[model samples]
Target chain A: MSNWVLKGLQSGVVTTRYPRKEEKAQGISPGFPDIDSQGGDINGREEDVCPTAALYGDSNSLKLDKGRCIHCFRCVRNTGHPVSWTSGFEWASFTEKGTPFPKIFQKSLYIRVVDSGDCGACLNEVKLLNNPLYNMHRLGLFITPTPRQADILLIVGPVTDHMKTALRKTYDAMPEPKRVMAVGSCALTGGIFSSGFTSGSGVSSLIPVDIEIPGCPPPPLAVLHGLLTLAGRTK
Target chain B: MKLQETVNQMQSRWNTELKIDLDLSAGTAVVHCERNTVPPLCGWLFNTMEYHFTGLVPEEGTEEWKLIYFFTGEADLGSIQVQTSAPLNEETFQSVSPIVHAVDWHEREAEDLFGLVFEGHPRLGDFVLHDDAWQEGLAPMRSGFDSDLAHSQRKPKSNWKPRKVLDAPGAFVMPIGPVFSGEAESSHFLLETIGEEIVRALPRLFFKYRGVEKLAEGKSIHDALLLSERFAGTTAFSHALTFCTAAEKLSGGQIPERAELLRIFFAEMERFRHHIGIIEGICSSTGLVVAASQAGILEEKMLRLTGKLTGHRYFFGLAVPGGLSRDTDDEAIKEALKEIKGILHDLNTLEKLLKKTSSFLDRLEDVGIITPQQAQDFELAGPMARGSHFCNDVRKLLPYGMYPSLQFEVPCEREGDGYARLRIFFEEARQAAAFMNQAAAMIKPGPVYTPYSGGEGTALAGVETPGGASWQWLRVDKNNRITRYRIMPPSFANWHGFHLAVEKFAFQDFPIIKATLGLSVAENDR
Candidate 1:
């Protein structure tokens, strides 16, 4: 035990200085593709290449829905006319029903995470927040075991048939002044496993989503941005 | 046993009327037989021939249902696939679970998804589809079933009760999950105990089943590869490699040497991180917060290194049908090798500290024991079986990619306890790092991608995942669309025998035992 303590001291602090300062870690995210203005006319072939149809429309107008993108890189890497790729992890956004929490509840917030039917990647990124590097507890955010004491509900996965009831019951158990944040592409637009025989397209179909963080499985920093945004800490 | 000797014994003892197609180059044999002869043949192969019953794949046909029973043994025997057809009118097939216990869950999954009945199988319903949520006769995997149709949700059954195995005084059943507090996947467990010690352990998983195999029926090879990796994200690269290998076999395409070596490198990297995550789980379960945090930090570093080497942290969108989608430069490979070596040094230091912590050892040593015989009976895979002295590794038994040229040891322990499993994890992680270093040195300058047009054929491929040997069997049409996609993940094989380690343990030991096993619900549920 003494040796462990000494080893801990030797390792020192590895926490990131986010919110106060931007996290400039390389390879922290698999960034999404953005249509470059200088590129030639869109042949509309790139839209068809997207397996999830995140990119659509013709040469007249092109659209990229980040919510539906799983960052497969087909549009940027495999297409003849490639789109420019941007590398930054802050991808969280406020839904129409979203607003920052009141100042009273800003200091501390309890989160209850639900796995509706995720493939496991999204949930894993969420788990990384508790690691020593991310250290979400330092930001006044915690993972509560019960929904009754939770101030926010964090969900991942496309809502599956079996988990639908449990997800709803968790929401109902939460107290007032509660918010729901859906993480990953599956939670936002069902990514690949869209509303099929077994699942709803995303979390918004069953519950009102306050925040949306989009990626195949958003990196830990992106998830941290979502949490801080809910607490009204991010600019 | 030699492949010819087994083939000759089958011909003489069983039926000479059977049609056999031998592919000696691929070391595979396909035997076409009657449906009535399946149980006997599977029993003979499992008991007499001592072949491992890999999985059972159920295929939908125009007028009938086809069942393919897979078996593999030592490299000499390779793999034998038995194909038989049953008419649509006959819903019942003889169960092989009574003789080969490993086929128990496979048969149950078929019954739930395809609405087939396994005769003489004691349990069938309420497996994948929960009785409270899904209506009977849904049969979602049928070809005629519409995937886009919306089905109304059902209310929980008021009369439903869990299966009870103990009726003694003061005995009661305790239910655990389907929903956990943290980021753990949803899985339920019912523990039946009379006092502090549990007598029966019943696990109910698949609450997050997304019907991945059914969704891949009409998808192209590219889209199907995405589904394979997403089904279980932790071991994403291994599953993708398995899918691509199966597809490549169908097209008969040759992979570049550089691509083959890179595949091994990325695969070892994934395995290294996965074992570290398991170590974190074990520490957390034992109430060692500092050690758990230290393990978590190491895992994060590994993930970042992986993302730096391959664009995605989990290796998504990296593996393609013929080869890799992108290439890593030699400079990047050298940098990754250095980082991995440093990580291994720190891991050794942590291991040394952990060994001295008596409190940690007391919790893990001699806890959650599974005997060697039990492992063989259940046909366990990966570290769980290795801890019990079952030394069957897919990389060794069925060599593919660069494994035939690589050097590594499949570590085993005779204790078959939590501590034994932990030691194997540390040892395997070291071996994985060594493999990555060797593969990095073997890398050469070459093309990484080879394009192959779709072809009509059926093929099976297996890869050694973090959990164990995961096999993907695929059948593609001439148009490059998948007709059947079946995944035999290691978790599904090992989950069948999890009860062996839990039944005789105290209730407090459940979480530790579960963490040590480290089975993924997403992999099994998919």
Candidate 2:
């Protein structure tokens, strides 16, 4: 055990100084795509090619729903010019009008992660938030066991019918003023498995959602940004 | 015994007419037999010939529903596919569960999805569909069934009727989960224990079933593959690779040599990270926080490397039907190789420390024991089977892509305990790193994506995932649209072994045993 402790020390401090300082690994994360403003007119082909229907465009303008994007990069690959990968990590937003940040949760927010029917990528990334490099607990964000003790409900996956009752019970179990942060495209817009007998379109169909963090499975940093945004710490 | 010899012996003994096509070049055989002959054939193949029952693939056509039973030999060298059809109106067939026990769940799944009647199946209850959501006599995967109409008409509330809890003198049942506080995936387990020891464990999975297989039907192979890759996060690459391999075979596309090497590279990288994640889970379960954290760091590093190379962290959108969607540059490959070397050094340090840590080993040493016979009976896959001396590594028995030339040892452990499973992970991590290095050297400059030409055909492909070998059966139309896409993930094949292994162990050791197995609910339930 002492040897294990020494080995841990030898590995040095693996924790990151995120929020206070930018992480070096942030550049590698696939963020929401940025449309090329100067290159060409919007041909609207990207809309047809997008598997999740995240991209929609007319002859002149294109719209992107980050919530619906799984970041397959088919748009970027097919168009070869109109759209490109962005380094901007912040993809969270308040869904309701005039909903102020809960000051009570500012110091220590207890999050209950609910898996309605995630494909597993989003859940893996959510688990990474507690890892040493992410160290989300240092920011007063902790994972609670049950919904009753939770301040925020972190949902991942497309809501499957089998888990619908459990997800609702979990939400109802939480105390009032609880916020639901839909993480990943599946939770946001059902991503790819949206239309099926077994899965619901998204989490919002069953419960009110405050924040939507999009990706097939968003990176840990993006997930952190979503939590902070829910707490009104980030723009 | 050779597969060809088995076919000859069956022809001599059985009265039924059989047409056996021995295509050793394809690594599979198609044995056409009458519906009445399934039981005897399965019995002979499973008991006498030492063939492991893989899965049952049911395909619905306009006229008839084709029931195909796939079985692999102990050597993993060849697979035998038995084809028997039932008319659309008369959808009943003899169950192979009585002869080969592993087919119990497979037959149940077929019954639930395709609405086929498996005569004499012990219990064909709700398999993939929810009990509350399931409409009796309604088949979801039938050829003409309208899924959109059914989904739109689904009731908002669950009709969840609880199963009867077992009771006895000092023996009561306790049910837990479907939602867990321990970050465990959505699944329920009903435990019937005597004091501190468990007598029966009934796992109620399918809470996460998104109907991935039903959703894949009628879609183009490319479109369906994205969903397949997401079937499970940890085994994304291998699942995608297997699906793509099946699609490539049906579409008659040639994968470039360079593309083949790249597939092996990505596969090895996926295996490396998954093993690390499993080891980390085991450590955390055993209260080895320091070791767990170290393993977590390694997992994170590997994920970042994969993110850097592929656009997505989980290697999504990396695979396509013909070949890869994107090509890795030589510089990136070199960089990845260097990182792998560094990971190997870190792995060596962790392994040394773990071996010296007596407390961690003590917790894992004798717990969750599975014998070689149990593994064979259940047809367990990957490292779990290897830990029980099954010698079931697909890369060695059925070499594909760069594996034919790649050098790596197929590690096996005689002791089938938690510690043995952990040791298999350690050995596999080293071998995966070595494979990555070899693939780096062998990779040559070539076009990654081969334009797919879709034609009418049926094909089957199996690729080794982190847990075990995932077998896929696909049938495509002339336009390359999938008519049928059936997947038997490794987790599905290994779940029975896991259920049996957890039985009779101390209830306190449940978490450790579960962590060591590293089975994914999504993969199993999908």
DockQ value for model 1: 0.64
* DockQ per candidate, 2 decimals: 0.64, 0.62
Residue B14: error of model 1 in Å?
A: 1.5
Error of 2 at B220 (Å): 0.9
Tell me each candidate's TM-score: 0.97, 0.96
Per-model CA lDDT versus the true structure: 0.87, 0.82
Model 2 lDDT vs. the true structure?
Answer: 0.82
Residue-by-residue lDDT tens digits, candidate 2, A1-235: 5487677788788888878887777324776667544342334342227787677774246678888887666766653444656765667777864253577667778899888888777888888887777879899999999888998999998999889889999999999888888988889888888888878889889998888888778888888988887787874
RMSD after CA superposition, every candidate: 1.7, 2.3
Q: Which stretches of candidate 2 lie above 4 Å from their native place?
A: A26-28, A38-48, A79-82, A97-100, B24-27, B74-77, B151-167
Output the TM-score of candidate 2. Answer: 0.96
Error of 1 at B482 (Å): 0.8
Estimate, for each residue in B34-55, the C-alpha lDDT of model 2 and write its tens digit: 8889988988888888877778
